[model samples]
Target: DKMKNKLNKQPYNTVLRREYNNLRNRITTLTRAARDDYYSEEFEINKNKPYKLWKLLNEAACRSNKKQNKEFPIEKWIDEKGKKMCTKDIANKLNNFFVNVGSELANKTQSRNPRAPTTRQRDSMFLCPITEKEVMEICKTLKINTASGIDNISASTIKNN
Candidate 1:
């Protein structure tokens, strides 16, 4: 409205318009410089900051429709036999490799002892009930930035309670 008023002036005050534009341009430049300086100083102070510094920006980028940094898709792979395999062929090769390795491991384990006690059995043998203080101490040590665990309770919530 102020700009329109200035533009629509009957007398066409060129001096007023020129001053207003000059001040506006200066303000823009000053504001831009100030913002840049602030960000630079912040970066310098936190030069060794972890990924958490850019977590929100990364999440926002992911949420946006624009692709930030796209990676080239792998269409084919070269095998030990110098065979260029398609996605399906690569998957089949992986399945065959796993099957062979798994069969060998299964046979070795079966031959060891049919009734060999597993890690779960060994752990359960030494299981002890946790104290309330132990639970709170563990919860307090948890990083607050982390999301809720499988139990759907956040560390902050546990700490507060």
Candidate 2:
């Protein structure tokens, strides 16, 4: 209210400006701290209850619990050709992107040196047998609850298994 009052009675006073800034910053800090404390407390209280925890999370995120009924999987997207793309077209586009993404990424990650890997370095290429422990460690490192990659396998699946 003080900030709004200050804005309404606009004056170019250095002291008033400084006081306003201080008050604004203090409000911001206090509100942020309070919000953080509230969320932390809520999370701690619901730590043992998955359903309650998720419900709280959805509420915090302003997510609706209601399911949306739609004929198509996704809304029609306008393509560069000024045509509306259907679900099949979208799937094709995504497939093409994922198929080429690996090579594109590999090309970008290649060493900048011009005189490197002109031929297959079969002599230097050696395969080390990875143990089950190593595999499990790698699997554990995979991020949980993430979107599936081109392989269509969820990281959570591999990590859990």
Candidate 3:
């Protein structure tokens, strides 16, 4: 009779305890499910990994704090292929390729401005000396030409003479 009376009085407390337990269980289940999903997604993403060969090449070229060898692992790749290639070789190839392409670009640029000369060439061709006597001499030497605004003669041209 006492047990039945206690149970009747505390029926609300019992229901509250049961609800708390159910919520806790649901939370644990959800947490586990989320963790599992995360790991599975990570696995799938990493399963067929995209090869970052260039990045690897760069990394291999870089020196590590632990090692003495400065050579990159790309050297091994070259070796494996039975092709004896060094960093200098690769660099030379790239330089030659760029030079060839650059010449083509320069040709196009030249077509656009045929009169444009390099700074050294332009200075050599157009620059005049700073002396009035030299200019007078040059003007006098060229009997056919009359000095209108010609003030100077290039020192180099005088030296050549």
Candidate 4:
């Protein structure tokens, strides 16, 4: 009976030990994977900054009428072999080019006019006479304009007479 009891306890101990080891291994793998993912994401974000700057430079160059080779230093980064490099390499080169070109362009270019109209300009254009007359009639009926009263005469009404 003692021998049987010892044999039973041995199997239980072995199984419990294996379960603990398996759990530890899984946790280690998961933590490493998480750390790797975080680092990779950080690297990608860092890489994209130069890429975005390069794209902005390219867009600005495209908008201008000047030839790329003559107007921008980015053309110099292109290898003589004519094969395009990766975005990261191109971006790094272009960022440097922009630093050189941007200052010159800023000094030479005039500031753009504000797109939207000023408050005075917006208020200058009034409603059309035909629509204005309809509005005036409604106001007269409501007795909202007590000062000069409302003009009931409309262009079409006078024309028909």
Candidate 5:
């Protein structure tokens, strides 16, 4: 408070500013150390209770109260033929399936099922086209200073223009 008051009284004083910054740095360091110590103590006390351990960890991490997904990523998996597969192998399998799925679907569609109905069924169709004006209005309402995604069009440009 004294350093802060001194700095406030002489805003342009470099010595006061330096002292204030040093005082603030010391306070921040001490506070952080104390917090770490408290968290460490809590973790030690709750080591036996997994729920409380996770709760302490979440608190230390500043996580929300929402129940988080507890699913752990598969590091290694057992495949058919009793073979142990690495993450890369599992990833390749998934990738290959996804890559071929479209072609497989197309092939199946080309060779239509014999049990299919021959009638060309008709149904009511509705189409609504969003105008450029509406699109621009929405773009204008976007939050500014955000990252430009894959297309590299800036949020500032979208919001302003």
Candidate 6:
């Protein structure tokens, strides 16, 4: 197939990687710029650029991952209640099941081995505050290109900053 051939071809793959990187760089620049100049008309244009680039990147990834076979549909799923569920219902049922199981496991573990009582002697002198150097070291040790945190800051950004 054309897709398979493209993946195999070194020149094509090089070009593809370059384009993907360029898009990512442009998107990141636009995003930071838009945040600073939120009220500007250019912000409107900047906002949409990332989404468009993301869409193309996602499509390319999907295409790269695809095989010759067509995607198959899930017929149905049976929940713990022995009731047949559709595709939409399956996710919620599985989530609830896993959550309940996790709680049960936690309770069982806690009952089996309880925590020891804390000693009266405190060692506050031994516990020193973390330094800026240590903080930077910790950030540098983190694996890059991972998903952003709840604050929407990436590990690379934190490490670099």
Candidate 4: tens digits of C-alpha lDDT, residues 40-103:
6655666668865555555545565355655534434655588656667888877889888978
Q: Which candidate is the best by TM-score?
A: 5
Q: lDDT tens digits, residues 11-108, model 3? A: 77886557666776888899989976865665566556545443343444563346677666655535446897887877787688887997788777
Q: Least lDDT summed over 10 consecutive residues: which range in candidate 2?
A: 68-77
Query: How many pairs of residues collide in each model?
Result: 0, 0, 0, 0, 0, 0
User: How do all models score by TM-score?
Assistant: 0.30, 0.38, 0.23, 0.23, 0.39, 0.24
Can you tell me which runs of candidate 5 are displaced by over 4 Å?
66-161
Candidate 1 lDDT over residue span 30-104, tens digit each = 998997786667666666786634643454355554667675344547867887778887779788989799778
Order of models, best lDDT first: 5, 2, 1, 6, 4, 3
Candidate 1 residues lying further than 4 Å off, grouped into runs, are: 1-11, 52-161
lDDT of each: 0.72, 0.86, 0.63, 0.63, 0.86, 0.70
Candidate 3 residues lying further than 4 Å off, grouped into runs, are: 1-12, 49-161
| RMSD after Cα superposition, model 3 | 29.0
For candidate 2, lDDT tens digit of each residue in 1-161? 86668755977776778888888899999998998898889999989999989998997798979887756546657789887888788989989999999999998896777685466767686788999999999999999978998999999989888
lDDT of 6 at 47: 64
Error of 2 at 154 (Å): 22
User: For model 1, where is the 10-residue window of minimal lDDT?
Assistant: 52-61
Residue pairs of candidate 1 with colliding backbone atoms: none
- Clash pairs of candidate 3? none
Better of 2 and 4 by lDDT: 2
**Candidate 6 on 6-51: residue-level lDDT in tens?**
5567555777767666776888899878755643544456567886
